[model samples]
Target: MRELKILAVVVSLTLLTYYLVEPFAHSKMHPHVDAPNYNFPQADKVTDAENVEKAKVALEEAEKAGKEKAIKSAKTDLANAEKFEKDTNAFWASAKAAIADKGNVANGEVLVTSNCTACHSIESKGFPPVMDNASAAAAYGVVPPDLGTAGKLYTKDYLVGFIMNPARASKVTHKFVDGRVHPMPGFDWMQPQELADIVAYLESIAPKTMTDKEVFHNACQRCHSIKYGDMQKGTMQAFTPDANIKTYMGKVPPDLSQYIKSRGAKYIHEFVNDPQKHLEGTAMPRVGLTQASEKQVVGYLEKVGDSKKAQREELGPKFLIYLVIFAIFAWLWKSKQWREMH
Candidate 1:
């Protein structure tokens, strides 16, 4: 009877102690922090001083972080944004006029082959796949017809407009001839001069062809970017950590791996080749490569930029499978210890 009473007393003491001390123990491990109150007249003055000091330190840290991010974002923006064309309208018109000129197509063709044809074949031989009418229509769900007979089929105005905004004119406006959407996107990155030169060359144009993971890396990397956008603009309150690579670019380099894709690469190339080329008053610079180098870079871009789509698509299942496996293992491991403790 005495032993039963003593046990009851011990249990009661434990319950009491737990109720009183458990809160503090939990608080120690995961503290509930709040800003100090400074509402009282005397208390407010003293707390205000401390708050001001803390705020100043925080502001300085934030400013330093901001500057770093701005510089890094500037680098990437400069690289990709440099290619955007100034006046898209002018670009198409000039290209039409230039292609009509005699030496233009020959020179442009030479430039295209020396730079572009290696990774991008003109006619549909077997080697590098051609992004011709049939394939393009099947892939994009619209017809771009064929560039093979672009000179014969399209007027300078039509050709120029098509090249300037392929999506708008080719997909949205025109009838589907080949049962494929045009694969060509806008070249908003070209400078006025570069656009004119390329357009003049394309006037009497022909056909073309195109590659792979290993072969892809070799041909498409130079002018092709796997990343885009200014990393410096967005931040979640100070010290909370930036949610993306752009946030870190101020302190560390930004990763271009996430943004690279066919669509993104095309956009990036345009930006790099021309700054004010898209909008009226843009501020990006041309990297100023020879025609051959530009084409090589574009080819390389097709490989690298295209790879990201496949890679990202694969990540979801992989992450979920791993997470489930980890949770199961954690449960199994903890079960033994729990039983032993009980």
Candidate 2:
């Protein structure tokens, strides 16, 4: 009994340590999402247009003031803007031509049925009827999303890129706290046309009216919840006399109301793409979401979590101080008890 009591104390302290340090560990492991260095020619044109307008205004003011240096600077800005536009147009034209060819949707359907059905469901009610949350959560740490709504959630280009190489397409490099890499294996062996066909098939079957919240409901609510105001919303079924979720999950999953504030947007994105990377043995599985869908989910998390983060963070130090005080008193009490026993 004494050994058992010591073991219980050790286990309790281990769980306490995990809870206290988890946020700090996550912050250290995955910082804020950094901007990608890759240039987007299409988006640059809008910035160039704004620069051109500013330069024109500067030129007019310089000429009115008879300031040669200011006039020269304005002309330089105008020249740079024109050069950027010219280069951007050329790049955009070439990129469009390279990816101009469309894929066959019929072939894509065949491919999806043959290759993807084992781990994924193409239809909402098909063979191996969309694996239930518990079984899927047990098998892969999370339920695989039905592909029927995927086309609506993702763009054709993003779908193609992800199907070809999930890790490369995601561009996530942060190592998980446990040092596990992404669980997704790349299918780079597939030809471009074949991948394109799969994208087409996905698009063909995707629901057109699926909203961001609906996407979260479909893909995430199974293991996560969002508490807003006074209402709690989630996909998990309510527990009853016969069905206790704790038996399956060990404990109820954490509420995602403040997840973005706790984990950061980049961490969320990386985790969604592959959760095993950030947390080994995590019940959250890779949802195989397109970049757009992932962004939408993260956007929702940020919107809900951003408002109260400052207040929460402000209280963290106070909590730590209280814990220290409590620990000191507890130790003093234990020492006094031993003295009295002697």
Candidate 3:
């Protein structure tokens, strides 16, 4: 039918626009980034890459000119740099092997309690952070998550690198230049065994089974409150008051209630894994969540925002069929009228 032909053209164009044009536009807007690299192989990939070699050469030249101390320092620097690169590249695999071989859960607990509890909480032990969000924001410029699910929700390797170096783990080491200081500078100085021990402790505290909602709350609720996400309209709030978050962060973080629908899964995953990649200088810190945790967070976001996604998809084809059927009936009626005119 002529009507059907026009409708087909309209539908084809719509599908092409949605499936092809929109995706092409988005790809240009946000260039593709590989999945988060827990190993952080090139943690200082951007900033410290050239500097290390340059510094060593300069130090070597100084040593040649009769500065005995400079030669020794250059060798030390070169060795240290080489060791750090090797360790960082191999950190994830090494951490897993260490944890299995010699991870001491008890010693890890002691280490985390003494060193990590000041900023983080271990809900299983009922240890709240020593400092509240306002004070924490003043210190770190953003709120931090509780370590309640860090063990299970984060990959073992991510936990290791994150503990060893926060900025490196988050891919934001450049922001810490000129002694600017990250709120939580990781204990990179810790021995490999020591880092493994702390990870072992965190793994011990995680719940064996967690619902998607629990994953979201532990990972996200501290800094981002959901929109109308509470029992009442005004019930939900970030751990820190908006004023303190805004004073340093420059803007209130957007409500994530509808972001799953707006930003879509691909964008949300990349953004959450590394905020700096999406929004340069965004105050949102990479929380170092495991892929499973990221999936659960996205799942919960979908549940809250696009609860009808599955239903809509199921009904879409049926609705299109009904439209076509109606179009056919109208076309039939119009043909009968044309016969009368003839």
Candidate 4:
């Protein structure tokens, strides 16, 4: 009876430990958010007539002050504003023209392989063309993402805009803590028809049904590895040499083997969508994955972290019932033994 009581106490303590530690681990992994919430400037607002008036006023003020630098800056701003107005009008015209043409997927595939495959991989198999992420990180600050899932992950309109002008599509300008800016260069050189074809090719190659596992493989596996039993999905090659780590990220990235258990699904979703939003100066840039893909990645993480979670939950009530019956029998046996003694 005493041994059984001790066993029950141990089990109760173990359950308590899990409950307490789980919450604490989650809290540490996902503290209160501190990063700035950036609102991207709309294209319409960028070329608004009011901005032209403001720039004109600033130009006059700077000229009156006789400040060459200020005057030059104001003039530059005014010129840019006017140019954007013109460009916006042209973009709409091109969009209308492109909408009528259903693009050639074959031509787009060729274009992607020729131009894009230099930095991004369309094929899911084998090492990517830009295999050296360390060197790529040194040059571009962040390793470029694989284009395997791009078609399914982004809308046609967004893909078109991003292909035309990456910087404009992603309006937020990310500045690193080391005073370096990491901006994606625009590809305004690609013609509208060419851009349309590339989008079509991407759509052609996109997975019809992207499982959660595929999401993790395509998006997270480049920098992270998941260990399921003895099987490993990706390599954990050093992002860069230790000497250059400070220049890039300031610290080595953590293994995400148990990230879901430690951080929780909500934390994973927010972090995956925008890492900088959770941790300022994090090396993990926003990969621009769709909300669905992000959720799928989180789901994959949860599965990896606790493969038997469903089974555990299903057995919980039955286990509790057994414990109750055992306790009653234990009490009854003890009572009977004491009664005999009396």
- Clashing pairs counted in every model: 45, 1, 0, 0
lDDT of 4 by residue, 1-342 (tens): 787799899989998889998768867876665322221123234424555777899999999999999999999999976775666556545554443457799999888888887777555634274767677666665567778788887656557766665643443333432665443555667777888888898888887888887777677665565544224544433434444444555555666768878877777766765574566545665555666777777777777787778999999999999999998999899899999999
TM-score of each: 0.26, 0.45, 0.77, 0.58
- For model 2, how does the per-residue alpha-carbon lDDT over 66-146 read when each residue is reduced to its tens digit? 989988988897886677556545544433421344878899889889877777765563646445655655555445556
TM-score attained by model 2:
0.45
For residue 326, model 1's alpha carbon misses the true position, in angstroms, by 1.6
Write the residue-wise lDDT of candidate 3 on 18-75 in tens digits: 9999989988988776565443344335323444676678776977787788777887
Off by over 4 Å in 3: 1-20, 35-101, 231-235, 247-250
lDDT of each: 0.41, 0.62, 0.75, 0.66
Which pairs of residues have clashing backbones in candidate 4?
none
The window of 10 residues in a row where model 1 has the poorest summed lDDT is 235-244
Better of 1 and 3 by TM-score: 3
Q: How close is candidate 1 to the true structure, as a TM-score?
A: 0.26
Clashes of 2: 1
lDDT of 1 by residue, 1-342 (tens): 574698699989899779878868866654442222211122223433444454555556656777877556555544332222223233434455433444455555555455444334444323343465344334443222323333332344444444455533222322223673334556545444444444555545532322222222322221222343223533112111223212212232223344345235444444433322332232222332223334445555544335355677799899889988997888778787888999
**Pairs in clash, predicted candidate 2:** 141-283
| Pairs in steric clash, model 3 | none
What value does the lDDT take at residue 12 in candidate 1? Answer: 93
A best-first ranking of the candidates according to their lDDT comes to: 3, 4, 2, 1
- Which stretches in model 2 have alpha-carbon errors above 4 Å? 1-33, 36-101, 125-130, 171-185, 227-254, 260-295, 302-342
TM-score of candidate 4 versus the correct structure, residues matched by position: 0.58
